[model samples]
Target chain A: MAEHEKITMAQAFNQALRDAMTADESVLMFGEDVGALGGVFRVTDGLTAEFGGARCFDTPLAESGIMGFAVGLAMNGMRPVVEMQFDAFAYPAFEQIVSHVAKMRNRTRGALSMPITIRIPYAGGIGGVEHHCDSSEAYYAHTPGLTVVAPATVADAYTLMREAIASPDPVVVLEPKKLYWSKDEVDLDEVQPGIGRAVVRREGTDATLIAYGTSVPIALEAADAAAAEGRSLQVVDVRSIVPFDDETVCAAVRSTGRAVVVAEAPGFASVSSEIVARVTERCFHHLAAPVRRVTGFDIPYPPPKLEHLHLPSVDRVLDAVDTLQWDDV
Target chain B: MPSHDFLPSEQPVQLLDQDGRRVEDPKRAFPSDEDLLRAHEALVVGRRINEQAYALVRQGRLAVYPSSYGQEACEVAAALVLDDQDWLFPTYRDVVSIIGRGVDPVETLTLLKGDWHCGYDPTEHRVAPQTTPLATQLIHAVGVAHAATLRGEDTVVMAMCGDGATSEGDFHEALNFAAVFKAPVVFFVQNNEYAISVPLARQTVAPSLAHKAVGYGMPGERVDGNDVAALLSVLGDAVHAARSGAGPSLVEAHTYRMQAHTNADDATRYRQDDEVAAWQGRDPLLRSKAYLTGRELLTDERTAEIAAKAEAVATVMRDGLMQDVEPVPGDLFEHVHATPTPQLREQAAFLADELSREKVS
Candidate 1:
């Protein structure tokens, strides 16, 4: 047994990379500036020096090439974990990912598999503009051959990454940039609750508030704010978007008889819409009112000064929760 | 460390001239009678299978087939140069190469038959499935080659694409990595002049596709794609260079697409019959047969025996493909991930219930 270690979300992620590399010799990590500079956010600091360049190296600044390279390596039995540096910056690479990475294993009828995990820091509130701050998880979630997961808590950052790397399907783990500095106690060696399921952050009965990645904290705070007003709220962090925990989400929505789905992406076509659809379909009879959504506007991610209106703020989440209508049909 | 041995000539190479005569070059390496005969037979069988597949597509027995009718020399020579330790990365227009690379006809054709993505086990033959999206698989070849180098395995990888595929960004990326890493791999671009209707003039403005490699700091060579013996020698040299870690080489095999890109495409829309006739005059099979006859391997009796063998293989392929394939009930529920998600499991169970008549669609 190993001793417990207090860590930040970023630190936990760093440890997760180290742990995965240590666990499997075939696990290779590479991306632009990931080696000598330890990643743009310093999440991979000391990995190159520790793991050596063979395991942890930097690639030329070409996302498409990086992903295609990973595709080949995975087919040949190496598990590659590539960092996209930022969320929107990963868009170019997703072309190779969608056309090849996602479909390769299925195309080969399981004779070949891509266990590559693409790690990207996503969402706004870090004050970075444009490509650095936009949330792009929905694109990956919509692709059939991909598994999408995000960690809201420090502990999940470690466990979900292990789970993502261990997954046979190609996975993209969207890490929230704003939550990077958020700290919590985590025992590196302890086996806590595993990943790929929704986690109830704070439980209550009046309504269920669902969110993931950067919105989980906002949902939790909203739950607290609603609790002060005597409106009990259940906060659920929806972790895996593709293989969403429909059972957990539906069960919480059914028990509470009302729901609010939240995300930092546009609501028209997003993880939030899918969650609302599933919760509405499964919890139709138990619902007290229409399921509400607190999401980013359909506009392109704006400058940081106006991001408060675009991001799912605590007030925005509570606003959605407040309009449950609670009237009998 | 810099580019080495790059010599892209203005004219395409032709070891066997137009009149079915050998063009003697004192400096070039040549093959033995056995290698030439093997190349000839591979071309013969590959064309027979290709012709059968074309007929099958027309008869509604096949979904699609990108014919390699006029490019058999490129197909045969590319495979003949590789040992069992090497990997062959090919494109969808490469059924001939697949057969030449030793993949079973039925297994290789299953994907084109609309039955599966790829029915054969790739690891068994070291041949990646035919990539349909242009030069996407080029990097995969380099990646595998790089991995092999890291593991100290002296395995070479041969990646084949068309003239149009060289226009793709993935092609450049593959060349860059192969040269930077000095991976043991060969980029065999069969310049068949057209890509699904777009002509070569529109495909690239470059003088030749082989010249694309010199910019990536690797040797690039051009070969006569229809001349099996010349293609065999050129690809053989490139394969040897790669296997010995001399770095990647690009060989542009100049040829012509004698048929429509696929059953869905009409070659008449973009090409002329006279041009096709001109290329048909230098058909890979005719030239190879002419060369094999000169070597006394294509004797009258042996020609009859080879035709009989090719016919038997075509019959087997037809029978294997014509048989009924039983798809498993839960085929859709399998292998989406190493472990299925809980929701996926629930959906699968729901599907099972529906199939059992307990629930309706």
Candidate 2:
């Protein structure tokens, strides 16, 4: 076992990829700028030099070709972790991810399985231009044959990458760019389980704040603020977005009776919206107030100054929590 | 990344005379007469299936169908190049190719019948669904070839497309990828002169479409698509080269569409009657009959027997089309996703309710 040391979220991702590559010869990485440049966010730093081009390299600037070739490579018994430079830039390859990568096994009646990892640097906190700051995880989560996940901290980043690589299905791992520089203690040597399960970050009795990716930190901050204000707030980190730790969500919402869903994606028809709808239906009898969502506004991710307004902040989460009918008793 | 070395130049290969006589060429040696006779029998079956499909369109059984009325020779010839284990990626016009490859005619109609997906299993038949999105399947075929090579399998992927598909980005990418990786694939471009409405001259600036293969570092050749013997020889050579690890090859089959593109297309608007008459004189089936008569292989009674068998096959297919088939609405949701998501399940349930209400009304 390795000693736990605080490291940035980007470094954790880099270490996770390195650890996984060392353990399994099947793990390979490829994307534009992932080679000598260490990836745009440096999540894949030193990988190309360590593993050589056969195991890690840069592909043509064609997104569809990269994903389509990864599908071929995975079908041929190689686990390829593809980097989609930014979340918004992954649209060109969306068809491949949706049509072929997700559907290959089902189409072939289990003859083929796509154990590919698609790493996306997503969310809108970096002030990166329009194409770089989109939270497109909901579009992928909506697609079947794919598992969607996001890690809000260093420890989860390390564990989730390894878990996603080992799964027998395609996985889309979105790394919130804003949290990439944030540091936390993580055990580098410990192997992690599959990323299909969610984690309860904080315990409380009054209400539950469910969030994933960038919003996890906001929910944590909001929970602390609520605790100080004499309100009990249970915070749940929905690490897996697609298979959606529905069991955890249902249990948390039922116990608390009040829920606030949070996400970096827009509130209109976003992943958070889906969560609220499902929770409302399943936990309808256990409700104290209509489920409120603190999320990005229904507009294109605006400029840097406006992005802070668009994204869900701790203040927004608290505001949503305050709307609950606590005085009804 | 040498500029000139990027693509290999193309050379067209033709072994049959306009009159359908096989030329004496060692490079174009074909199978024995018994093999050709078997192929001829298959061609008859394919023609019957095609005729039935054409009539189905008229009877409102199918949404649309592009008939290969006079291009049966090209379809059958391309399909005959491979064993059942080999793969084929065909376009929408390759109806005869599908039938020649042993697919049931009824299953082929499943696509135009608005059956959500391709009619047959690609892995089971090694024939991908007929690609309606132009040359996208070209790249997929190359990917399959790459997979086969990595697995150390000696299989050839035959990807068929039209002259118009050459204009697509997918075709360019597929050619480049295949050449760079030395993927075991053959690109069969059926140059049917017109791409719906645009003529070949308007499609490319090169003297011959086969010459475009030079850009991809592959051997490109031309063949008379209307001549079954020529098409078989050319495609067979390409397939052999691919299977033997010689790398990719492109075969440009010079053919012409005799019928309207579909029931909806009117070729008379762009093409003159004189042009159509000239090609009609060189009818591939008639030329085959002439050659068979010259070889003392076709008797009046044998010809009548072949015609009668073709008619019977057509009758069977037509009868099948007439029978009422109330398509189950539930089937639409079954294959949309391998395992339907919770959202998809909800959508399916919702649609089912709506459909049931309509039924009651």
Candidate 3:
């Protein structure tokens, strides 16, 4: 057994990049401030020093250029891991992401594969200003030919990052910025489940709370609160959003007969909405009540001071749980 | 060297004037007689391909065709400049250039025919899919060239765009990154006077498109785009410099889109006929033929042979495209990923059931 060490999600991510680069000579790391400055969040700290500048260097401040070239590099047989710095900042590269990075394989009829990983620091908890915090996973999740994953635990963060880099297709890693400093004891060598599989964070049978990325910990907290009130609320972390683990999610919903999808992104026509629709269609007979969604309001991310009012809170999840029609019980 | 050294000359480079008279360029040399003859033949074939594509669009065999009717010089030269190991990144209008790279003419029209996103294998042909979004492929070219440099390969990438594309932000970013990293990329801008209906004046206020490259600290050259001999010589020089590690260069080929943006566009809505007639006097094929005959490099027999070859290619394209394409419903689920998700599998099955039901009806 490998020794377990207490580390933050940021450290886990940094270690993952270092390990992937060390393992594959073709793996490269580049983006704005990813060099000696080690990314704005320092998730890429010490990588440039460990693997010379040629392997881990900083790119010019151009998001579209960074993504566009990453596609080219991937086409030429290099595994490139690019950092988007922040969630909102990735919008400049949206055309490249949707048009080329996401469609290159299908566009060429599988003649070319884009083995590129785009890491975006997403969601809001810390009182950072607007644009610094956004749950932009919905955009990536909606695009085809892209594998989107968000890891809530330290162990999953490391393992998922490694898997994302190793995948032959493009993967979008939505790292929770607010959880960067959250610490957990984890064995670095312990490989978690691969992408496209949901894991149950907390087991129960009364109702299921489905969440991902920054919302997983919040869902767990809400479940703990429910437990004190004699309710057995289950938590299912939907780590992968695109190739959604429909089997696991549907099974969980069927077992509980109720589901409340959770995320920081706005609920209207979002990944949360998609989840609710899928749960409704697949578990229509098993469902006890209408599937509910506890998500951010359908508005632009709020100012830092009022973000608490905009983001989904434990009270909101419990309130949604109450609406799931416990009258039958 | 100072950045000013990279500025384009006051006059665009020219080997043959519009009258097919040889103009002396102290810094540039004419291509060998053999290369010139080959380039002329390619120009002839490229123009024929454009004509046939127009006919296909009228016949409803193709959804639309962006004819590179008058830009044959830039199209053929860009393709002829690269070695077999090199790669060419082309735009939607660069089908002539794509075919000149030895890609099958029928496969080149696949996207326009609406049969597939791309009809041929990019890796096998060393040509990228015809990119529709302007200036995006430039960055891809830079990245590929940079990768080749890292792997210690002598591959140079020729990225083709237009005058209007140079106004895009990705264009500037690509040039800046290529120069900073010293990637082996040549950005060939075919300044065909119009991007759809928008004229060059509406695109940029810069003195010239090639002059924009000086800001990125790379050498820029402007060539007479209608003069195939000039395009071949100038692009050949740029490619050679990149292959030898002189870093990236930007070459702006001065030309005109003699045809409308596409068969769907009405040229009379944007410009006067006189403007088109003026450029017709500078036709690339006419100039190439005149120069070849003047230099005694072209014989009647050679011209007939070239014309026959062009006709054969056009016939093949017509025959291949006239055949109905078989659509596979299951192919939609394939190639989305190496392994389809459970959701994708379920969706695929549902689609299959629906298709079968329709068949019964």
Candidate 4:
């Protein structure tokens, strides 16, 4: 509890994993660079030194093998936490995720449950290559039997990680790559039950800006800027994608009369689009304008130089709020 | 000359003589009349279940039913060899094999019913779900075998797939993995002549599916799939080898598909009726019936009784189809995650509200 001093998101992640591994013998971790190099992102640093190779180790370079072996381990009463070096590298393992892990429990009529957590540092803004900076939470959300969650703050990251590790089903915790180095004060003394609820990062009366993962900070920044311009912008950081917090989102949108969903995933069939459609349906009578989405373009993740354009920035979110027809208000 | 190598080219075991006489192979353990009748009843049940499933598909009651019409003996033989504690990994067409292991017929139909993604649980009755993605379950079976061996449990994992699955990379990898690990799993390859529309020749260049096991350093045997006795004897030996910690063995059951791959698949485009007609002459059921009739164990009256009972069960299944469980609108979001994420919960609630409004209107 005394380690509550300011720490980077990576350090928080390392601590969360260490705490989980020490608390439960069933919690094992593995990935490619996880052993000797302590992960490419160093999110799993010092885990190997503390837990030894058996509890924390490196798998073959094959992502499918890592996931498949994890499925086997889970079936045999072991909770395995797998790390994908980057968001894009997790694609090869998608086969196991979709065909095996997600469906194993339901396929076996609830006889087998995959208590596997896949830690992926996702979304651009980290200056990574095309494959490394992918925001593919949409792919996992679309998959049945897999819980998709993205933590925006250091506290949420630390809390949600322990929850994900203890979950009886397969969970994908998408850690915001840009937030890895973002430092914040976190308390890891107590456990939390935030299974599927969005937190109100900022309360306001104007348009509600909905976002998750890396885009959460941009939405908060946009809200702050909106307040200076005399617009009371409410911001909601949607932590979970599968079982979304409709109550928080709808309540916020009902009061604001305007909603703008944001995400780093491509706009086409993106999680943001789903959010926009839901807001339009539930908050239509209170709407000052059609629900909008401030998200990445329909194209693939752009190069590092152009990622700023692809990702929804504070200015883009502000523009969405400003352009909304609020004359009725 | 029989040095126990038992190459596919060597003399294959036979029980029924060419003249339709009952002849017991001295080298094999003969099954009792009770066992043979049980096998016969299994074939009848398998045939009836396939017929009912196909009928349901035609009536718009099911999405697709891959009929296990022609491969009942292979399933029954393999299933009968397994003890209660042994595991069986079945492919899409193993409805009969699972049923032979005492799996409820209704539960087996869930795959066709499209109620579950994986369709069956392996832990219950020591049988895995019906694997639909070709030979993927073969590797899973190997892993299960490895797990059993690690626990020092004397159990055989019988993984069954079609001839076409032999060409899959997973099948080869599984075979190689099992051989290297010395996993106690029997690889049952039902070489039912064609894989979907692809003939065995196109599926594999290897002389025989069983012979492919030689490359992996495992024993292989080719058997007359129509001859249930031969299949039972071969699988029984393989199962024993696995249970005794003798490593893996591959059994290739040589048979033919009497029906189309599925109600959706048209065999006319790929195969000729002559091929079908030729295989029809070698109907496994007829040979078994001939053996039974010659020995005075069965009669036309008993056969009629079996058919009547099967018809009654089919009627019951058809009558039970009145319950149309239209999926609940928000249920799709239920199992995706143990707890739907905050975002999905919002969508589910939104949908619920939308439906409520529609109901009020």
B1-361: candidate 2 lDDT, tens digit per residue? 4544423233445555677586776667765665565556656766777778888888898788887777777888878889876788888899779867867666666777664346666666777767676777777787677767766777788989999999877788778778877888899999888889899889899867777888777878888777777777778878998988889888888888888888889999999888888888666676666666677777788777877877776776677666667776776555444455455677789999998999899
Name the lDDT value of residue B93 in candidate 4: 88
Candidate 4: residue B105 Cα off by (Å): 2.2
Q: Alpha carbon lDDT of residue B50, candidate 4?
A: 80
Question: What DockQ number belongs to candidate 2?
Answer: 0.27
Q: Clash number for model 2?
A: 12
- Give per-residue CA lDDT, model 4, range A1-329, as digits (tens): 36668888888788889999999987889888998799988988889888887788875466765676677557656788999988899887787789988888756656788899999989889887778899998899888788889999888888889888988998899999999999987676655447587888999988899999999999999888888889999999999886677778889999888889888788888898889887888888999898888888888888999888888889999988877887755
Off by over 4 Å in 2: A1-30, A33-57, A71-81, A102-116, A153-169, A180-197, A284-286, A303-306, A325-329, B1-12, B22-39, B197-208, B264-277, B297-361
Give the top-scoring candidate (TM-score).
Answer: 3
Model 4: DockQ vs. true structure = 0.24
The C-alpha lDDT values of all candidates are: 0.86, 0.80, 0.93, 0.81
TM-score of chain B of 3: 0.99
For B170-283, candidate 4 gives per-residue lDDT tens digits of 677678767876888899998888889988888877778888878878888888787777777778888998888789989988888889999899999999989898887677
Local accuracy of candidate 3 as per-residue lDDT tens digits, B181-285: 999999999999998999999998889999988888899999999998889889999999999999999999999999999999999999999999999999999
Task: Report the lDDT tens digits of candidate 2 across residue range A1-329.
Answer: 55677899999989889988999887889888999999999999999889887677887677777787787566556788999999889888887788778877655446567889999999988887767799998799888778889988788898888888877788899999999999987776655534657788999999999998999988999999999999999999999887677788899999999999998788887899999998999999999899999888888889877788888889989999999988866
The regions of model 3 sitting more than 4 angstroms off are A1-3
Worst lDDT 10-window in candidate 4 chain B: B1-10
Give the deviation of candidate 3 from the true structure as CA RMSD. 1.2
Q: After superposition, how far is residue A108 of candidate 4 from its true place, in Å?
A: 6.3
Provide the lDDT at A237 for model 1.
89
